[model samples]
Target: MNTNAEGHLARQQRVGTLIDLFAATVEEHGARPAVSDESVTLTYAELWAKTEQVASGLRAFGVGQGDRVAIHLERGVDLLVAVLAVVRTGSAYVAIDVGYPEQRRVHMVHSARATVVVTDTAAQDSPWDEKLVTTTVGDLTEATADATPVVAPVAAADPASILFTSGTTGRPKGVELTHGGLVNFATNAALPRILPTDRMGQVSSVSFDAFHYELWCAIAAGAEVVVMPSVPELLGRDPRRELKRRGITTMLMPSMAVNHLAKEDRDAFAALRVLCTGGDVILPQACREILDGQFSGEFYNLYGPTEGTTACTAHRVTADLDAAQPVPIGVPLDGCRVHLLDADLQPVPAGGTGQIFIGGAGVARGYLDEPAETAARFVDIPCGSSWGRLYATGDLGRLRPDGLLEFLGRSDQQGKIRGYRVEPFELERTLRNCPLVEDAAVLVHGEGDGKQLAAFVELAEDGAPAAVRAYLSERLPDFLVPATLIKIEQIPATANGKRDNEALREILRDDLHRRERYQKPDSRTERYLADLFEELLGVEQVGTHDDFFALGGHSLLAFRMHRRITRDFGSGLQLQDVIRHSRLADLANALDADPTGRPIRA
Candidate 1:
């Protein structure tokens, strides 16, 4: 670690502030292309001029230092310009994805108390009524066309932006990042590894915090930030083809990179030089596959929360994959410190697992308007080496003998089953190692009194659900084996691209109900019910009276059940018929009714 006082100060002062750093970049890389998409490309000079125009327009709309401007728009060159413009005006930009639900958008608008909104004309119908002043992307473009360029003075500690984390449990919380923190994180922690000539792939939506790293890393390094439009197939297909076409030398997240590398033609990434994979736990298997199969580029495993301004600790993956039970999270970046401590905030031994705490300049101010949560996670550490604030990550991990941190599962995610602590991430990693499994998610199922483990897996090409289940049964202990394995074509993801556990749980609940309906059959209708249940639930054994919910049947599965029953049993079953006769016995009895029989008295 180079801690030379003059060198540290130089690095800090050079990239010390966001607005100043951006202005300096504009001057240095004037005519170079800064951002490019299919529709448009903006050179550094053009981007600077446009950003000034937009900033001037925003200033006219009463947006200034500390004011929040929520930008609800799709991924495009204009969105990049808008964000920079907001920062240039000394206002923090809050990115809200256009695909977010109306209620979520409303909540974010109200939560951030945004003074202005930048969106597109197509997003005009969004539920953003009169709550804040609105400016369309088109409007900003036209309005800023002729405005004079003026650099706004912003301090290092000034709030640069506020990004909302994907709210799985409740409403999304806003994370406020300072310009100093972001610039420091980018220049010292991220940019050193990125080459000036590299063209980096920007895949995540702007709403995600990862985008902040991707966008800034490119501009600060004078690298090309290639904007990949969000397409359904792009999420599911090989990203390397497009990446290679654009000569993408660096990528930020592992999801797309891993998926692309898993393809048969791994030679697509031959030109790639650096790949950073994070956002979720990077399975060792995925890491090995990347190293062996596709990328010969430098690979890093990055870990951090949104409040930490993208990433705090990064580990450069070595060739040794089988040596450790879990990969090390690597050492902290420049100006950052990682501490493992007990409940009382005392430092734990190197080999013992403890809650990981992060301290340093990289840590953000705290969640916007969430003072309680902010205070709870961010605490002053008085007993440590020196005076500084530390954030309780809620993540459990241990420091290796070599001082590298190895991440254990989340403290909250650890559960006791049969007097043994179980980590779902371990199970998920094991399941993904199977050749036939494309992806897997494990969730604890059933009511409290009868809870059991269930797994939902998406099979690889030419793979079957039963084969995946059987394979896992062979590798894992009996208790660890998923009681039920449901296969789907694809795993659904949230707007931010993390696995949608809530959606998966809903599917499991529906499955349990369908299974219950199959078990309690009262008549010969059990036969038809069994067949329909097997086809609908994608499971082999379903009794006549089994409840749909018990079988992990969800609304989509229910609709599929209705269609399959109606198609199989002819017009004898209607959409209402399936709902009315939810159980096998009830449906069979209904089928047994004679058309000529007299109607019973109500």
Candidate 2:
């Protein structure tokens, strides 16, 4: 083993500390390919030269130390070059995930108050960039008047990048990472295991902090980074064939990878060497699947947040997890420390659950420009002898008897249901264990006075909503039972692969409205009204007009009503027909006029 203390000491250095590594790669692997995607391949020397040119171009635009630059581009060579260029100019790059909604994109840009926004011509049309200084990839790559490279002085503590994280409480917060912090993290967590002989798969978007590890880990170690293009099919398609095609030896992501493995031919990924995953709790079943699958690779679980660089705790998944209750996050990376503390920041007893606190070079500079928020998260290390502070991960976990870290759910996600603290993840875990459910998400709805649990689930080949409801009723307590159960083809996810709770909440809100739209009927008119409500609302039960929105019925639902009436009942209902006839009884007259014998109008 190479015994060098340089990697450990480098964590305290400033952001520009890795400039030498980039320069050295160009000289040593000048002709060797560095980044390869379907459209282009760039050698280390070529990439270095282009990065220098882009940096020079950026400097001409006055980007310098402490300046924040934004890159709103797709996953491509140009995007990589832009990131490197900003770093080379001694400014941190704020990656804007192209998939971000206009509002979130604007929030990130304005929050950063970026000096310049680097994007392509296609992105300039987006309304979000209207007020920012925009630069195109075409302009940066185009030949310009001769300009000298501008070098800015950088310290290890200086901010190198700002990663925006979508927190559950509010809008996204920017996590500031120093150059030394990232370099140290990459060295300790990635370099020791990866080598130049490895062909690594880069799957996460550049906007995510995980991509930072993917890109730099390869470049710093002289390994080849295979850039996978972002395609709709690739997002939901099997990656096994692609992984094998590129000879991809390593990849890292959350448990979602299990979904991909389930769909692909098992033999396709037989060549994979190392598979690292994290972001959320990995199910025990998923762990068993990987072990029994085609890839004979070492699997590692990395745990941390954008605020703690890439990751602080790691657990190498061995065969033991196949029989364990929950896998531990393992020991801390070199130069880092992990602590499980109670509400008072006091160390908790071994085997007792507590908040996980991380301290070391991995901890970031906190949310950018949000002083109060920064102070709240970056608390002083009360139990450690560290020179710096510790970051309260907001994640609830505990230390195992073996000193390994076992992650519980988020502290904030813990909510009271019927006077008992209920963790949504716990319910979700139970739902998933039924073997009939493919995936499940539980959300606590309502406020202050009346809170209830709602569950949305996607079933396996052998399950249905009714069966799942019955199964949960038998396995869980009455308080833990969901008020509403929805069955979807698949659960939508945020760009980072986490369950989109907001979206699910909207679905539940709609379901509630649908339930109240139509009441039971005592007469033929009322029965017809209930049938109309069911057909119009696309739900089995409806009680009243006040509940239309809760049933997932929107303005588009109005259009369906208009079409149904026009076709079956002779009434030529317009778009406004549904709005005026919000109640089932009010709409029943229109259906009566257009009776079943009438020919449907266009």
Candidate 3:
């Protein structure tokens, strides 16, 4: 840790894998704190020693190089140890988010064909127990008590991790990443902003690619990576206040999270020295607000795919961000190449939108067990230099005249919601899998700035939309679940046997503008709620059945709506109610029940 940037670079140059770089950090500063959660802190030496023991135990348990080891633990010291142990064994780790349903976890683990699952004590009896070996983090000490410390031989090209993301075919695909790509990202992109003494919050969900950026880069810098006590709550006392309490200096938040924070916590936000954000497009208004706030931190807009080892491009947001124009995604990382290509793979001129193609050391080895998809997406660029295969990002963006790149929109059906990449086919396929569902069409609906998932479902038998939503909730992650559900007579189709795009749009438009459901104020409470919902959602009329999120209401709007409800009616509507009870009917009932507007949490 005493080494300067030059010496740190030299050490990293000698290492081939992330584990090796971590080992170098441990050797240089064994006593410095490397990782911590609310309850415990582990120094670099302690982490390395524990990881070696766990690696030895893994070897004793028949874990070998390149084997897939599923880490299903929560965000804590044990989770970090499991990840390091897998790396120390030269095995690619598969991260399973703690809150994911068993079905989703099963699908991901089966897809990766993971040989072992390291989880907490409660998850020892998962459905995959018969197919794979299971171990609890609590038992790692005992299991490795008799085993000797050892670091397995690792190579630069060996598979380092397998991150599962949404697939068009309804199943999640495992994106295979290599040690080289991981190291390249840390060296070229992350190191410039993070330093040895910098403390960054580990705020990203474990399954997300951003988590990798937050974890590995901090380890490379010998910086403390504190586990956020809450998920994506920028104004919370547990995580946000905890970060400030611990004097955390840096963090990489998603754009949505930053946007929400900008609205309320100007004083709290100005505390950091480095803040990097990007997942979907950042609203210029939000960016300008944050930049013009109390925070003087370096704010960056990063863009990339899981296939590009986290981020391939980054731009430091300047004070010139205007509401009329988009914040640029910026230039490529050092040693990375960005190609904005047309349909024919020809380079598009500057200021012309094209499919983003990344070619460089950061390009991953494509999806696992899907050779056709791999070949289709990761194609060889005809005019590429020694960069090799180019990863088709399937995102449209243009190179600005100033050498920066501005993101447009997705060229495919995939879209991002709350920073998680989602595909409608995945939700539609899950809907069709339901026993009563005969036909379904999942669409991304909304205009200007954001989108939300909607499902127009036709069931064989009489079914409730709420029931269908609940069933889907058991299989899909919360972010992938559609905020709106529409029951239909049948899925409209054209002569070509495909979905009738025009008809579907008409259906959506009619639902939005359905004048039949519109009624005058029935009561004082109803009038108040209707006016509030209409104003917050920017809709003309509000029906009791009209959903808030379906009409383009997001977390930010929900917060604003809740604030007004409290001030106007003297009813302290909780934030949870606004987000969860999005229906006017449900909220109206809640409001009527409590004069204070306080929900009972039933």
Residue 393 local lDDT, model 3: 91
Q: Tell me how many clashing residue pairs each candidate has.
A: 35, 22, 1
Per-candidate TM vs. native? 0.70, 0.69, 0.91
Q: Write the per-residue lDDT of candidate 3 for residues 214-250, one digit (tens) a residue.
A: 8888887788888875443433232346667878888
Q: Listing every candidate in turn, what is its Cα RMSD in Å to the true structure after a full C-alpha superposition? A: 14.1, 14.1, 4.1
Tell me the spans in candidate 2 whose CA falls farther than 4 Å from its real position. Answer: 1-7, 10-16, 128-131, 143-145, 189-192, 230-232, 259-268, 384-387, 414-602
lDDT of 2 by residue, 265-315 (tens): 334356778877766566666677667776677888888877888888788
C-alpha RMSD (angstroms) for model 3: 4.1
Q: Compared with the true structure, what per-residue lDDT tens digits does model 1 show for residues 1-602?
A: 11123554577777778887787878888888888888898888888888888888898898898899988878888888888989988889998766655655777777888999888877766777576788875677677688777566788888888887632222367888999888877776433477667787787767677787788878777777888854222433345567777778887764333433343334545567987766655556656666776567887878877777887888887688763366677777777777888887888875998888887778989888888888888889864547678787777888788878888856776443321234566667777888888788888654311335788888888888668766765654434556578887788899999999899988876875654543443344466666767765565667765655445443334545654544445544555556667766666667657343232222
Off by over 4 Å in 1: 1-9, 166-169, 189-192, 231-233, 255-270, 413-602
Clashes by residue pair, model 3: 270-295
- 1 against 3, candidate with superior TM-score: 3
**Best-fitting candidate, measured by TM-score?**
3
List candidate 3 stretches off by more than 4 Å. Answer: 1-12, 189-192, 230-242, 384-387, 519-528, 543-574, 577-582, 585-602
